[model samples]
Each structure stands twice: as structure tokens, then as C-alpha cells.
Target: MNAYCFTYLFTINYLVVSVIEQMTDARQSYSIAIKNICQSFKESVEKVESIKKDSDTNNNNEILYNFWHVFIEKFQNEAELHENVIQETKAKVVTPLQCIVKHRRQQISRLKAFRTSTDYTLKECAEKVNELQSNYAEMYRIHREILQTKAIKDLLNAHNSYVLQLHMTNAMKAYYHKFVLPQLMQEFEGIVRENIIGFVQIFEYFCSIHTNMFDQLICNINGVQLKVREVSPDSVVSVIVHNLNKNQNPTHWQLIEYLSPDCDCPEILCSNQIIVDNLVKVELRDKFSELKRQFAELSSFMQQNVNIVDTLKTLEKRFDFDTQTEHINLNMHDDIYRKENEIRKAKIALAGIEVQESSNRYATHQEMHSHSSR
Candidate 1:
């Protein structure tokens, strides 16, 4: 019985050892299969991640290109409008003042295309944005300088007009006092003696021509005032006051009161001629000084506004390029993060397979030992 039991136990042990070996082989095969599947999965995920990254990069680049194109188009339109206006003004006016406007318009047109182009790569866009911004800054500086020039020209024109008017008025006064008044006195004496109506006809014609000249001057001055008002209302007031004060002649006041009825003042009596002269001078000086001060204030305010416009243009240039680059970088970063996560997941799956293989080996070994004991 002991011999039989030993044989049976030995046979059972042999069968158990075979089963354990088969289980180990099967577990090893399964492990290999899992490993291969894990490896394939990892490779597939890598390919997918790579494709996703490529697609994301392509999409980002396309968006950036489109955005740049749109920005360039906007600038182009603005530049075109400025150019057209400048050209039209130059053709109509033919003034040195219009030359500066034309130059700025040309500059705008030259730089408009730099805002976008498919030929430029991502790196080139950054460089171009900076380049364009610098150009724009220079243009702004030139524009301000030109505006200063226009102001100077306007001042010179006003001075010339004042001088011409003064000469003409003095000439007319001299002609009337030296020639016209003596002629009129002689004609009146003759008319009284001979009863002639010729002097009346001559006087009426002379008065009509004088009235026409006066009207013409008034119209010219009014036109100048209108233009000055359009450009800077405060400055027009200053110019008017300056001219009036610089020439304190009674004729100037008479002209002013005649042209602008609102400035009419009632005659005032003074104790002394010197005191009246001094008072007139003081009033004219004070009025002109006030006008000049107000003009200076308005001019300074306009300059500040121009500076603000320049600052905004600078900011726009910076934002246009920066926004596109940042968006592309952000997309790239997201793609990289996504790829990392995919790799991490693949590694985790591989590790789980390894754990299963170890468990199968341990179970097979335990079965073998138990059969040997039985």
C-alpha cells in the first residue's frame, strides 16, 4: 500500500508539474502578447499625438496668417484713404503745406503691405511688426513737425495780410487828405458859384468804388477767419487780437468795428489826450496778450492729442504681432502637454501587464508546490 501510494503521489506530482509548466508557458505567452499589445498601443498613441501636434501647429499657423492678412488689409485701406485725400488736396491747392500731407500718405502706402504676407514665416512676422512700428513712429513724428510748419505758414500769411491792409489803408487816407479833399473843396466852391451837378455825380462814383473795395476786404478777412476757425477756433481769436493790438491805429479799430459790428464801442470822453492814448494802448495790449495766451493753450492741447494718437498706433502695432505669436505658442504648448499625457498613459498600461505576468508566475509556482506535497 505504501509503494502504491508513493507511485500515485509521484504520478500526481508529475501531472501537476506538467500543468504548472503549461500554465507558466501560457502565462508567459500572454505576457508577451500583452507586452506586444502595450508596445503597439504606445506606438499608435505616439503617432496619433504626433499627428495631433502637427495638425494643431498647422491650424495655428493658418489662423495667424489669416489674422495678419486682415490686419494688413485694414492698414491698407486707411493708407489708401489718406493717400487719396492728400492727392486730391494737393491737386486742388498746389501749396507747400500739401506736400507734407502727400509725403505722409505715400509713407503709409509703402508700409501697408508689411502687415501681412504668406511669404513671411513666424519669425519674420515678429521682425516685420517691429520694423513697421518704428516706421509708423517716424511717420507720426514727421506729421507733427509738418503741422508745426503749417502753423508757421498760417502765421506768416496773417502777418502779410495785416501789413498789406495797413499800407492800403494809409495810402487811401493820404490820397483822400492830400488830393481828394482839396478837389472836393474846389468842386464845391465851383458848384456853389456855377450851380453845376457834376461834383455830385463824381462823388457818388468815388463813394461806390470805395464801398466795393471795403466790401472786398471784409469778404477776404471773413474767409480767413472761417478757415482759422475750422482749424482752431481759439487760435483765430488770438490772431485777430494780436493784429489789432500790434497796430493800435484808430483806423484799425474803425475797420474792426466796421467788419464786426459786435465790437462797436461808444465814444468815451477823457480829461487829457495823453491819458486817452495810454488807455487805448493798454486796452489793446491786454486784449492781444489774452488772445495769444489762449491760442498757446489750445495749441498745446492739440499737440498732446497728437502724441496720444501716436501712442495708440504704437500699441496697435505691438498687439497685432504679439497676439498672433502668443496664440501659436499657446497651441504648441497644449499639443506638447497632450502628447506627454498620452505617453504617460501608455507607460501605465505597460506596467499593468508586467504586474499580471508576475502574478501568473507566482500562482503557477504555488500550484506546483501543492501537488508535490499531496
Candidate 2:
């Protein structure tokens, strides 16, 4: 009914489409970020695993109850959690629903196209209207007996019916302009505002899910850490002494120190002065080199993905979907009212022409009656 409102609605719909495109891009970045984080984390964990591989071996002192094994397992679980977020579920019963988003976007485009096609008056109607007007009677005199006085009365009756239909149409126009349209716009504005609120809430909710997962993981590890702490080197030595016959008791017990993620020079952790090192360095050399390569790749991924996450965070804050849509929605009713007024005037104008045609027809009918009576 309101041209401006309809136009604005279409405009808002296009904006929504644009926003969806941007969201798709942002989601892609998020997936890549998750991928990189998981890969980097896996490499870091593997490095520690290699360093502590033989801590519990036959000839060595164990490192803090073999905690590196736990690190490997935990790292796998942590990576799996993030990987699940980006990847489709492996279950056969639940298929991916990504197609639904695409279909909905297509439907919006279809709606826009359909509305654009049907909402306006056709050129053909105007062209045919220009060819012949209803008010101008044919000059052929096919009904020559028409009388002027009888025709006036008939026209008055027709005029009343036309006025009644026009009255109804105008009443609806008034109701829509004053109440229905404005209220509909207000509700729409609220919807847009709520979407913005939800957008921010989604950010907070996702962050909390990851943060809580990591926190709970740490808590569980802390709960189990006391077991490792309680394991004394003397108890370990006593177990070893009994396992092997007490035939050969080594006087020198090499105490194992942790090779952490921060350690750059892993050679220092190896028990060797110059003579043992000269023998051969072969135990974890391959693992160290492999981890080094993986870490390099992980570092590259981390930089790109972390920057993506940061950009998206700023984008969410900077974007104002509500403000963008509110201006159009709030002004729509006023525009509609003006357009409805135009429609009312056009209806009245056409009605005047049709009423004049009724008078022309009535005169012809009455003249025939007058001639028959005479």
C-alpha cells in the first residue's frame, strides 16, 4: 500500500543478504583459525612427548610419574573438541544442515524478485486505458430512444453504489496508514534490535564454551597432579632394585629434569659430558626434528588465524545492523501513508470517469423506453 515502505523493505532485505555474505566469510576465517590452533597445539604436545619418551625405560629414572603421556592424550582431546566445531559430525543419522542457510538466502532473493514483478501497475494496462475511455460514449446511436431525465436518475443510483465501494476502500487505507502499518514497523524495528543483541550474545556464549572447557581441563589435571607429586625417586629406585636382581647397583643415579615447551636447547637435558655425547646422539633426534618442522608450520597458521579472529571481534563490535535497518523501518509508515494517499486520489479520479460513463449509458436506455411508450 505504501510505495516507500515497500521500497525500504526491499532495501533492508538486500542489506540482510549482504550481511549474510559477510558472515559466511567470517565463518570461513573462524574455521581456518580452529584448524591452525589445533595443528599448532598438536605439534607442541608431540615435542614434549618425544622428550619424555623413555623416562620410564629400563636404564633411566622416570620423569614425574610419566605425565607426558597424559599431555599427549589431553592434547588430542582438546584438538578434537575444536576440530568438531568446524567439521561435520561423523554420525550418519545427522546430515549437515548448511544447505538450509543457502536455501533461505535463495528464498529471500526469490521473494524480492516476485514482489518487484507484481507490486507495480503494468504498462499494458495504461496503454489500453489510453486507447478508449469508459466515460466517452460511442456516437453510433445504437440505442436512439434514450431520454435525458431518466438517465439522470439512473446515474444518481449508480453514483451512490460507486461512492459506497470507494468509501470502503478509503476506510481500509485510513486504518492501515494510522494504526496497522506503524505498529508493524515498530515490531520490525524491535526485531532488528534483538538480532543485534543476539549477535553480541553469540560471541560471549562461544567464548565461554571454549574458556570453560579449557578451565575444566586444567582443574581435572590439577586434581590428578598430586599423584605425580607423591611419587618419590627412592620409591622408584626400590621398585627397580627389586625388579632386577640386586647384582649390579649403580652408584650414580641420573635425576631427570623436565624439558619444557620453552626449552630451546634440548641437548642440555641429555645426560652426557663430552664422552657419552661422542658415542652417538640417536634416541629423540628424529622426533625433535619432526616436531621442529611441525612447529614452524604451526607458527605460520597461528599468526594468520589469530589475526582473523581479532578482526572478526572488531567487526562484531563495529557493525550496527540495528541502526542501519532502524532508519528505514521507522520512516516506512510515513512513506506508506503518503503512497496510500496517492492511491486514494487515483481511485477517486477513476471513479469520476466511471460515474460519467454510467450517465452516458443511462441516457441511451431511457430513450429506448420513451420511444417504445410513445
Candidate 3:
């Protein structure tokens, strides 16, 4: 039983340490991601600043305007938005994680100390119980020998009876009170306490990870919002027009003519609409889909963590000692009940021997009286 309890404690400790390591790894990964994102942001800022400096003297202000509106500013905004969201998410997750990790490490240290103390006490109790059992065996042996020796009937005088009574009074009572009951209670309570604490720690680990994942989902949602705001129809039109102007090398009127050669062309900006449908829609749709998929995955993992927490709660309830109204009895009770029955049997046997010895003494007295009368 002691070994089993120790094994359980070790296992719980190992698992908690493993989770902490995973959290550390996750934080490292986030650090790397944030570093990369910040680097990208720095590069985009430099690129946009360089573009502004170079294009300041450009003759075609229209080209400069379109490029800045379509590409440079868009990249800047996207890079800044991503950097902000990633930093925010890290703040939410990493800060709490550090605290939790610190707290758990302290908890584990305390638990180890408690387990060591309990183990020492248990050993002492075990040694005391073993000593008591040995004493009991010796007492029973001497008792049985005294009972069987009929030749010593006269020898079993006042002093022997006093000694027998003294031994029985001291040894039997002490064995039950100091050795048996206290040991049983200690074992039961220790097991319950150890397991309950273990389960609570596990539950805490799950909650921390669950919360972190939800924070990540929030970050992704922020990304989705930024994408939506930045990837507009006007942005698409700017990109298309810039690209067309670069490729065709035509004046605005010539490009318009090329785009709308027919007299009965669609009244709307049919060319921009076509570019939006064919190019912008497909790319944005995939982006949105990817974000939604990420969100769903985080949600699912969070739910799994919730389920684990529920299971831990149930286990904790089973071991709870607050109310006897809902006690989850241990399996050791049957063994304890068996020991109680054996003790009762011993008491009955001892009583029978005492009565037989009294009867023999009375018969001997009567026989002596009869002989005197004769």
C-alpha cells in the first residue's frame, strides 16, 4: 500500500512536470512567432518608408498614389495589426502561464515535502504495529502454555494470575488502540488526501491550457477582422489598375477603351467587378476559411480540456471527506471487518479457557471436601 501510494504520487508529479515543460515549449514557440512577426513588421515599415522617399520625386503622382494606396499602406497596416494581435495574445497567455507555472512548482515542492513526512510517519507506525503484533504473539503463546499445564495448577497462584491480568490489560488494549485503529485511519486519510490533491493539480493544468487556447482563438479572430477591413473591393480595384497600367503601358483613356470596346457594355465598372470576382474573391475566401478552421480547432481542444476538468471534479468528489452523507467507501473496509471478527473469536476463546479453569478449581475443592468428610 505504501509503495502504491508513492507510485501514484510520483506519477502525478511526472505528469504535472510534463505539462509544465509543454507549456514552456509553447511559450518558446510563441516567442519565435512573435519575433518573426515583428521582423516582418520592421521590414514592411522600412519598405514603405523607402517607397515614399523614392516616389516623392516621381513625375506620375497617380502611379505613386495607387501604389501607396494598394500595396505599401496595406502591407503596413497588415503587419502592424498582426504584430499587435500576436503581442496581445502572448500577454494574455504567457503572463498567466508564468504565474501558473510558478505556483505549480511551489505546489509540487510542498507536496513532495508532505509525502516525505507522511512516509516517515507511516514507517514509524508500521514498526510500532509490527512490535505490537510480536508482543501479542508472545502473550498468546505464554497464555496457551499456562492453560495447558495441569501439573502447574497449584503453581498458578495469585502472582501468576496478577501477571497474566497485567499483561492482558497492557498489551491487548494498547494493540487495538495504538496499533490498529490509528494505522488504519492514517492509511485511509493519506490515500484520500494524496489523490485529491493530485486531481486538483491536473484540473488546474487543463484549465490553464484551455484558457491559453481560447486566447489564441481571440487572436485569430482579430486577424480575421483586420483581413476583412483591409481586403476591400476598392483595394482590389487599386491592385488591378496598378497591375494593368504596369503591363499595358497605356494612358487612362486607352485602357478604358480597351476594357470597354463594346457600345452596350455593362453600365457599372464591369472591369473592376470582374477582377474582384475572379482574383480577390478566391484569395479572400481561402484566407477566411483558414481563419475559421483555426478557430474551430481551438474551440474543440478547449472543449476536450473542459471534459477532462469535469472528470477530475468527479474523482475529487469521490475522495471528498466533507460529508459522510456521500462517502465513497474504500475497499479496505472488508479486510478491517475481517480482522474485527478474528479479534472477537479470540476474545470468545479466551473466555472459554477462563471458565474451564474455574470449573476445574471448583471441582478440586469439592473433591478435597468430600475426602475430608469421608
The top-ranked prediction according to TM-score is 2
Give a tens-digit lDDT track for model 3, residues 50-138.
Answer: 64466422222232223223322322222122223344434443344343334334434434444344345434444454454445334
User: Model 1, 1-374: lDDT tens per residue?
Assistant: 01221222123223222322232233334434333433443443344345436541212122212222232222221111112223322332223222222322332222222212211322343344344434433443444345465543443333222322333333333433344334433432332222112212222332233235444323333432332223322332233334323533333112110111112211211110111122233443453355356445545554554565555444444542232354443344334333332332233223323333333344346556767999
Better candidate by TM-score, 2 or 3: 2
Sequence-dependent TM-score of model 1? 0.15
- Stretches of candidate 2 off by over 4 Å are 1-147, 212-374
Task: For candidate 1, give the lDDT.
Answer: 0.31
Per-residue accuracy of model 2 over 190-241 as CA lDDT, tens digit each? 4333432332233233334445555644543453343334444344334443
Clashing pairs counted in every model: 0, 5, 0
Worst 10 residues of 1 by lDDT: 267-276
TM-score of each: 0.15, 0.27, 0.24
Error of 2 at 227 (Å): 43
Clash pairs, candidate 1, are none
| Best of the candidates, lDDT | 3
Relative to the true structure, how large is the alpha-carbon lDDT of every model?
Answer: 0.31, 0.35, 0.37
**Where does model 3 exceed 4 Å of error?**
29-166, 177-179, 209-374
lDDT (Cα, 0-100) at 230 in candidate 1: 35
Supply the global lDDT for candidate 3.
0.37
